[model samples]
Target: MSENIIQIEHLNKSFGDVKAVSDLSIRVKEGELYAFLGVNGAGKSTTISIICGQLSKDSGKVIVSGRNIDDGMQDVTRALGVVFQNSALDMALNVRENLETRAALYGIKGEAFRKRLEELAEILDFKDILSRTVGKLSGGQRRRIDIARALLHKPRILILDEPTTGLDPQTRRLLWDVTEKLRRSEKMTVFLTTHYMEEAADADYVVILDSGKISAEGTPLELKNKYTGDFITLYGVTKQELDKIGLPMETVRDGVRIAVPNTAAATELIVRYPELFKDYEITKGKMDDVFLAVTGKKLVGGNEK
Candidate 1:
């Protein structure tokens, strides 16, 4: 999977007066977890819409598995699977019926389709609710069924547009675990967009979009290191110990932590008062720090929310 599975170039989109995406370009390597990080109205959905042929771009190119969406989408569509933010299941239909309907649409039939559903049911573990109405299931259960439906045809790449948005923490973790497992077993490229910085931290690569354009792009650790300062956690650092160091530190769990501008500051303090520093560890900045530094706003766009 050395080749780029999805590529976009000079992409532009608009809604009357607002420029949704401007000269946006991106490349997603095959079989990697690629995250698109942004807040609401950041064009994440618009980009997904264009990719899935739900909406058209005003200008530029999109290539999926070497096939352009404009040039007969059969090859491209066959290689992609998408689960939207909102539930797509027929609320009135049972889980099995919904899967069956979707499978038929994909032309998966007879023994093969039966076998396919069985396999998905085992991995996704929704057999208990298979005969129950989708509307009766919990949000997490519904999400699992939705994911099972998307993978029934076995697309090479899976795009989750804010898939875990409203889930509880436990449900989110469960979904994330299943997603990672599926990607590993199927070698499927996972592309997702989310406002959850914690969720984005797990991606192999991340690109933050603010106001529809790429604001920053890097691996999670790299982004944190580049945009924010280093911090140190000191064990056994006390008030008297702190006085000799002459550096401000916050007390925590019989220890202290300090944010230093650079390695030099940390090393200087450590060397100056070796006895004072019982044990010290330097850690890179967090994703939230990176977000604040880059956007000059909170991760959720300034407000506490």
Candidate 2:
């Protein structure tokens, strides 16, 4: 197998007059956990659908597991597995039944299928709930079932679109650990789209999409070093007092206080007027700061485009 498990070239797609994705090209190396960071409707889902052969691209070449998705749909799709934000499972079936049915659909049955199910059950901690109906399971459990279903076919590349969207912090963290284990143990190439910046932090590589284009692509540390310099957060009793700082500052509403970048000039401003900014605190640059610097807009707004 090639080092690059998935490769996209000059991908373009449109719906009527609106272009969802445009001239976007990227590559996901083997065993890489690539995070696609963008808000809702930033074309992240559209791109994933195109690559998975769920949706047709207006123009572009999508290569998955060395097969062109458009040219060899069957061959390309056979090597790819996709899990959407919403669970795609038969709620009436038990966890094991769901996986068994999926495997059967892919022409896998008998002893080999049973063995694969056993392995997945042990690895994903689904042993206890194997006989329990999926509809009766908790949200986290259902998500685990969804993941297990995706792995039943044992594809080389896996794509998850916001796999942990509504999961709790602990559950989300657990999913991250599971994904790491899959990559390390199975050498599965994982590609995920997430709005959570913290999730992006843990990825091997991050691609920030905005307006159907990639704004930044690098490791989390690399992005922080390239964009964020410092942080200037102001702790004040009131918003009026923050406004009265009488200097340019990026106002961020974190419940009560406001925050701004503590750049070199901001340091000079503090040095010149120490009394005015006595209540302010300076900290290292944050991922939020890096996002703001790159987008020129507050990260609070969920609109990535």
Candidate 3:
């Protein structure tokens, strides 16, 4: 079994009378994609801040890469690379200049810095934009630069706090592709917090927080099986035809949707009603459904609270 790179024990934090985190404990294994999911004000940011030593916890311990935060923040910081929701690059500086400035902070200049910059430029596909000012780059390009800056020192753990918020779908895919490549190539552990359900669906493990506490935790498949059901939508069929089939179904925009227990049940229905299911689509339970069923709120535009 892989060792736990990040471990929080009985963590608690508060702001005035508002409790931000309450007895939160989680284990993130090394080199795995661990997703931390929650709606707004659900203590996700608070927990991350505590782990990174940006905020002091009222009670409990936070260990990163096996080094307790209480021991020495310098050691803890060296093991982490954090990409915040907002851009951290210097707007007036070019991409290369911004990267060089950040590298100097970690004492990573000379030949080592050039090799690392070239590597990241290739991995993130930013070779063409090295001379572009940070302010002139698009949202996707800026996000990639933010990641590259954070990764210059080769930290063991990468913390992405809503890394993709306003990018187009193509940019989102490209960012994910770069992240996956980095994870595999460097054996880096990724701690991600995002409002995108589809992105979290690809995580190795998911932890859903609700109101400063954990509401659910499991793999994507496990969560879907526990909280959602498969759906079969049949087009070109009316309520009468669905009634004649004797299956519980509801009217949808383009067709009637029926909830089935599993894939076998959906297959049985299709085979049993050949004519009725001429134009139908069977979809398994999705992360969006699992999120709604567990959290009692739907995500709107990937930013819903």
Candidate 4:
């Protein structure tokens, strides 16, 4: 079994009269992509800030790679590579210059710096944009550079906070590809926070937060099975036929949707009436449904509470 790389126990944080995080606990295993999901103001950012040492927790134990954060932060910082929600690159500086500055902070100079930059450029596929000004590059291009800067020190864990928020679909796919490649090659554990349900659906494990506390935690399929139902939509089938079949169904725009207890039930219906289900689509429960079932709010779009 993989060991836990990051662990938080009974974590709590408050601001004035409001509690930002409440008795939260989570474990992230090595080389796994763990998604921390929550709507805005649900304490996602606050928890991340505390984990990154930007904000101190009220009371809790935070251990990163076997070192207690309270004992010393330098080791913790060295073990983590963070890419914040907002871009942190200098607009006026070219990619090479920006990367050079960040590399110098880690004392990687001369031959070592050049080699590291080359490796990242190849890994992130940003060699062509190294001379381009950050402000002039596209959103996707700048994001790649942001990741490169964070990875310059080759940290064991990579924390991505809303890394694909406003990018186009193609860019998002490209970013995920790079992330997966890094995970396999560098053996790094990924800690991700994103509003996109589809993105969270791909995580090895997901933890949903609500009102500053853990609402749900499991693999995507596990959550779906626990909180949602499977749907089978049949086209070119009359409502009377569905009624005669003695199954519960609802009328949709192009067809009728039947709610089944599981995939086996859906398949049984289809096998029993192959002709009736000639034109059909079977869809399992989605992450959005799981989110809605657990939290009262939607996953995307809204001002943070």
Candidate 5:
């Protein structure tokens, strides 16, 4: 039987009157990458913190690698690696030195540490700037070093919080490519929480949290297929021009809105009318559309309290 590397059951946390995590349960199987998708303040970070022992849970229990997190905090933490949303690297230290210090903190030193460093550098393809100060590294390089530092301890499970946030499109794609390669090479279980729809779409399984609860759980395609109908994005010359078409559509920002029944309907419209709108796009279902359909909220984080 495959073991679950991380498990949380009926977890809850509160701050005065606010319930951060309520009745949350999640289990990540060994060697699988699980992505948590949610907006800000949806308890995704809070739940991860509890599992990592950074924050105490108000109720329920969390187990990491066969040991309860609260009862066996030391062993549980030792078996886990974390890459937070914010970079935790020391700007003053050189890249190698920063990793060396972190490796020592994990009780790894001497020849063992050196070998581990070499292994990580080779695996991560980070050879050119080992001696450079972290402050001088680009955002993507720093993020990679942070991930490498987490690996020095040789943890069984890795948790990344919004690993691609605040990066440009090219950088984001590069990071995702690196992450995919790492997953293939390391074969370690990974738990990632992010707001990026594309990133969530790439995960083997996604846990969608809404209003401090599990709103959806499935593979990316599964969630999209289950929740999303056909959608059409229409862009008209003017608002009145779009209104004149009179197709049922959901309004998006600026001059974009999605109409339903998707490709078939879109093709029918184009074939029959040919003059409804000057420009439009069509697709079966997307992560953003699924988010809207399931939560009744936009993926841009607006309309969310």
Candidate 6:
């Protein structure tokens, strides 16, 4: 078993009568890519804030990098870094200046700072934009610079809260590529929270919250295997047309979707209902399926309250 870098036990938080995080607990291992997922107002932000020492927890304990968050904040902070949703970059400063200022704040200077920047340049590929002012850079470039700044002190753990939220698909993939590579090279633990299901799919472990409580926790594959089933969607087919086959299915917007055990079952359906569907789609299962199954809600348009 890997050593846990972050441990939260029986964590509870509230605002007035509304509970933000209730009885939440998780053990995030070092060098692991952990996905912390939930819809809006699902307590994900509240929990992360408490762990980062930005907010006080109502009760329970949080330990990060072997330091209790409450009393050993200095130690915990030295081992942890966070890239929040809002851009933390100094818009007026050039990329190099931003890094230089942050390095100075962390007491890394001269040759050591130069060497550290060189190392990060290899992963973040920000060398080209070193002279470009942060506000003039694209969103993707800005985000990378933000992460590079967070890593100035070589923290053991990185907490990314919707780091790529507004980036295009290509930019998001680019950021993750750098992130994944750095995770391997630096042996750093990554704790990510995002609304993107596809991003969570690549995580080593996933924990989802709903209304201040953990709704599900497992590996992406494990969660999908347990919560979702193979299914086929017969596009351009009406439910009435499929009534002749007596297949149990739900009527979707386009047509009807029928659950199946495997390809064999899907083949059987196609064989029997050959003329029923003009077009069809077959999928084993997906993270979206697991989210819906475990939380009884959608990721994007679900009720937060």
Stretches of candidate 1 off by over 4 Å are 239-248, 252-254, 262-265, 301-305
For candidate 4, report its TM-score.
0.93
By the lDDT metric, which is better: model 1 or model 5? 1
Q: lDDT of model 5 at residue 175?
A: 61
Error of 2 at 257 (Å): 13
In the range 100-208, model 1's lDDT, one tens digit per residue, is 9989988998898999999988877887888999999998899988889888899998999898877778767877887788778877899999878888889999998
Ranking by TM-score: 4, 1, 3, 6, 5, 2
Query: Residues 57-77, candidate 4, lDDT per residue (tens digit)?
Result: 999999998888999888898
- Candidate 3 lDDT, 4-44, residue by residue in tens: 99999999999999999999999999989999888878888
- TM-score to true structure, per model: 0.92, 0.81, 0.91, 0.93, 0.81, 0.85
Candidate 2 per-residue C-alpha lDDT over 1-305 given as tens digits, one digit per residue, 9 for 90 to 100: 53889889999999999889989999999998898987677789999989877889999888988888767688877787888889989999888888888899888899989998888788778899999999999999988888888888888888989898778777677777877888888899899898777777878888888778888888887887678755576655455655666645565675233334435756786776576575666665666666677766554434643
Candidates' RMSD to native = 2.2, 4.5, 2.1, 2.0, 4.3, 3.5
Identify the runs in model 6 with alpha carbons over 4 angstroms from their true place.
232-245, 249-257, 261-282, 301-305
After best superposition, candidate 6 residue 156: deviation in angstroms?
1.5
Error of 2 at 47 (Å): 0.3
The candidate scoring highest on TM-score is: 4
The TM-score of candidate 5 is: 0.81
Clashing pairs in 4: none
- At residue 68, candidate 4 shows an lDDT of 87
Model 6 — which ten-residue stretch has the worst lDDT? 296-305
Across 1-305, the per-residue lDDT of candidate 5 in tens digits comes to 65888889999999889999999998898888899988898898899889888899999979899999777688987888899988888999999899999999889999999999898888667788899999999887888788898778878888988887766676567666756666677677889998878777878889989878999999988887788756666666455665655776666765556565545666776676567556777766878877777777776632252
Off by over 4 Å in 4: 245-248, 251-254, 271-275, 302-305
